[model samples]
Target chain A: MKLTNSMEGVTIVETEDIKAKKPVVLCGLPDIGLIGIIAVSHIIKELNMKEVGYVDSDIFPLIVVFHHGEPTYPVRVYQKDNLLAIFAETALSPESVHPLSKVIVGWAKEKNSSLLVSLGGIGVPNRIDIDTPRVYGASNSASLRESIKKYEIPVMEEGFLVGPYALMAKLSMHSDLPNLLLMAESYPQYPDPGAAAAVISALNKFVPVNVDTKSLIQKSEEIRLNARELMRKTSENMQKMGKSQEYELPLMYV
Target chain B: MPAQKRMPIEPADTWSYGVMWDHISGCLEPLTEFHDKETELMIRIDMPCVKRKADVEVNLTEDTVAIEAKMNRVVQYEKWGTFQREAKFFRYSKMFTLPAKIDPDHSKARFKDGILELHLPKKERRYSVKVE
Candidate 1:
């Protein structure tokens, strides 16, 4: 049962019939520290999610990632229970981000998703000195803000967010769909598994996933080593997106 | 879009899989960054899997910095991601050319959380001259 979804010039090809009931859509695109990607990847592996769909666009890079013995799309969709995650194995070009975000939000709206969450990292200069990275939250809706407050997650007070998650937040503002961003303090250049683990722990408080973060912490070194190339590529994209603006203070007086 | 033109291909030696691990040396290149500050130039290198500070070595000069560290154990990946090859890495090695010359003698280094931070004082110091 293959279903094709085309919107804003980006198509999502679902290979299997998805029977999720108001699924919570999660996005884990490549960004600083590869935090979101690592966290979402761990959840997918722990839950043994099945790859049911994939995304394609002309503006995307011309490449395919080989996992095990099969070649798969660089950007793919995986599902487990009511959890649907969109994971990116390769870096997204700056030009493709707008269309991709629009399509994802539109698809979420079409699915009548209960909530949409975007996991990412906030680059902190003193990450080396910090033992455990802190997770911060931002949302486009007031109810989601209350949920974040109830979870005791710090609200992102004043700063510019630049990347895929930033675009998602902006586009979801017009729609009734709530968009939540969980960003952990992370190293700007290197892949920070500690930061990923921190965000995962924070996300578990509200999301349905009950993932054990012990293995993630124990295998931090291995994850960092294996993700070096991806991290390097993500860093290049971050530079192009002016990711350093995240550290700058916003000029909002009110 | 206009008809795409066929571009000339580069040599095969330059067509790398973009992997961090070097097959010949069995060493991975650690991610590193350099910050050129006013008084000192700081270089931070991320070298995970390196357990003890004794196993890490750093060589600093006025214009360059070299680092090598041994992992706690040999890391083996039978089919690592896209680069389908069985390989083992024992250490992490990397070197960088500095953007500005520094006083190596006054440089200081510290290792924490598997990250090595080197602070090299710039040789040319700025004096606060009164504007007349």
Candidate 2:
């Protein structure tokens, strides 16, 4: 394992020696509704993935998270078989987003990852009236787009995507890596575990993961209540990143 | 040692002092959003774990709104943090000072999917003037 602590800002460190053949990289960064974080955390818990590494940076929050009687970094990497997930337990500041995205894509490129999937949520005004939130897909690769179509997930044709996942998508566009984003319609300010469940179900269709959404649905209320503080902090960060732009239409539809 | 440089402070950034829970009352502040429209100001509050709509209580005035909801069951946190231990929460409560004066008599509310939406009509009406 090559442990390179970059001088640029963010560093991806490998605490345990890991070797996987063309692993699939999954990102569960904090965003609107805390969708990605919730989904990835559930996946990590259900699959019993092991923590192999963590992300360290001076720009990150100056706090350590204690889990299961052990102190861990806010952002950590977990692995189960060929699946690799980067999960962030705390809300990231807006300034650290660019360098973090760069480091993640660069590391994925170095690993020769098969695909990079970003799980997130899209805020919708009428989310209260909808029982089952719909998931949308966007990819930089043609084959992935075909796969999305094959899976019958709606494609996000045109709109502004603002946040870390958006930056990762743009950065990976210039590289050979294939990046895919799956976002579910969710509440703008509240933690929506239902939306996270929807995204996970959608991801299960393409990714080789056997996970059920029934437990997620049954414990939706508890998840929302437990995730309140993170959602509040993430909402404030979203305001800093101009997340409302996602609601605006593209200037040129053609 | 070199002095650390601090980021510029903005008004909105300092608005929240980061206190959203009360240990004594065992009540939490729910996530809320406000939208200012042409005629009415809309406010939405997310109250998860609230089983029935009747359990929610809303009190409105000309320029303020208060909401309280009872959870379906008491939730116990074995470890909330280093400072808090075995905390129990049974309700959600919050109050907001509105941006504009609202006609409390004409305001409407709807609760669905654990979300409470309130439509408050502005007290002052806009009149179209004839151009000479």
Candidate 3:
């Protein structure tokens, strides 16, 4: 592996050279409910995307993901045409989130991507009672917010977003990069493919991926069963990161 | 000044591959939540493949609860990871210990949308005091 130290304490290795003008970057790091990982993985599979690169850091867990008898990086970048996605298959340590987010956002900016989209979940305690989870949207730029309105998605008017996506949004704002965060109501400690399907449906409205989610729904149980261990590890990491802050009422709201 | 303790080091071969393999291939332990309420302890288990309440079996005591639920069918994966073999799982099983004493007879449960929720009332209730 050709490891290049792009920034302090961060190394990125490119497996293949990618060339796309103003590509849309998607951040699907493992987080609450593993929604981002599930959605982005599904999208990559449905689009037959290929892995282009990976990000590595000393602070990350000492683990590697093995896929189809081939060893692969836990956190990888995949691309198909103009759509580039960064996803982590393994649970990341809390200490790595900030630096990782900065690297991802900075790298996307360097690539001159038109937009950075973050897919994630908003944990809902009563998720079991809801048949179809609702998707909420938040953007770092006014034009993207207008695009969200044009898509007719419910805007997250007022709330604190915790975890990696929050850091990415903050960095995006500082860099003046348009970013969108699409989150769905999900079970706090389980993989919810139903929520993932809902998020992808909303994404289709904006990106026109036209990917069908019926298969995702059909395999929801299997996904939930397989993702339990990762969910457990991610839950521990989330606790370390103080994800409960998402539920707290902001002092500025008063 | 205090010196930091050095971490232990072991040979790479000392780690048991079987233990790690078994952990990776073990039966699903349904994600659960335990909430301590004023009057009761609420436990919620997310078991997605369970089709009906009949498929679930719950054994409860004053301080512990054991759950076993059979899935509607065996969930199988082919060529999983480096194993390159088929793996099949049929059920979910887990046991949890409660923090406080619970009244087994007074406990109530409801299963909906593959989620099992149990409300275990505490044996002793706390009386609240109003301050002047």
Measured against the true structure, the TM-scores of the candidates, in listed sequence, are: 0.93, 0.93, 0.89
Which digits, one per residue and each the tens of the lDDT, describe model 3 over residues B43-88? 8888988999999999888988888888888777776544467767
> Model 2, residue B3: displacement in angstroms?
36
lDDT of 3: 0.83
Per-residue lDDT of candidate 1, residues B2-108 (tens digit)? 11112123246356645566755678888877788889888888988898899999888788777889998998888654456787888988777777788999999
RMSD from true fold, candidate 2: 5.7
lDDT of 3 by residue, A50-102 (tens): 99999988998998877766788899999998899998989988899988888
lDDT measured at residue B96 in model 2 versus the true structure, 0 to 100: 77
lDDT of 2 by residue, B1-132 (tens): 111112233355464346576655788788787888999988888888897989999998898888889999888888877654788888988777777889999999999878899999999979999999
- Place model 3 in a CAPRI quality band: acceptable
Better of 2 and 3 by lDDT: 2
Best-matching candidate per lDDT = 2
Q: List the residue pairs that clash in candidate 2.
A: none
Residues A49-84 of candidate 1 have per-residue lDDT tens digits of: 999999998888989877666888989899998999
Candidate 1: lDDT of B45?
83
lDDT against the true structure, per candidate, is 0.85, 0.87, 0.83
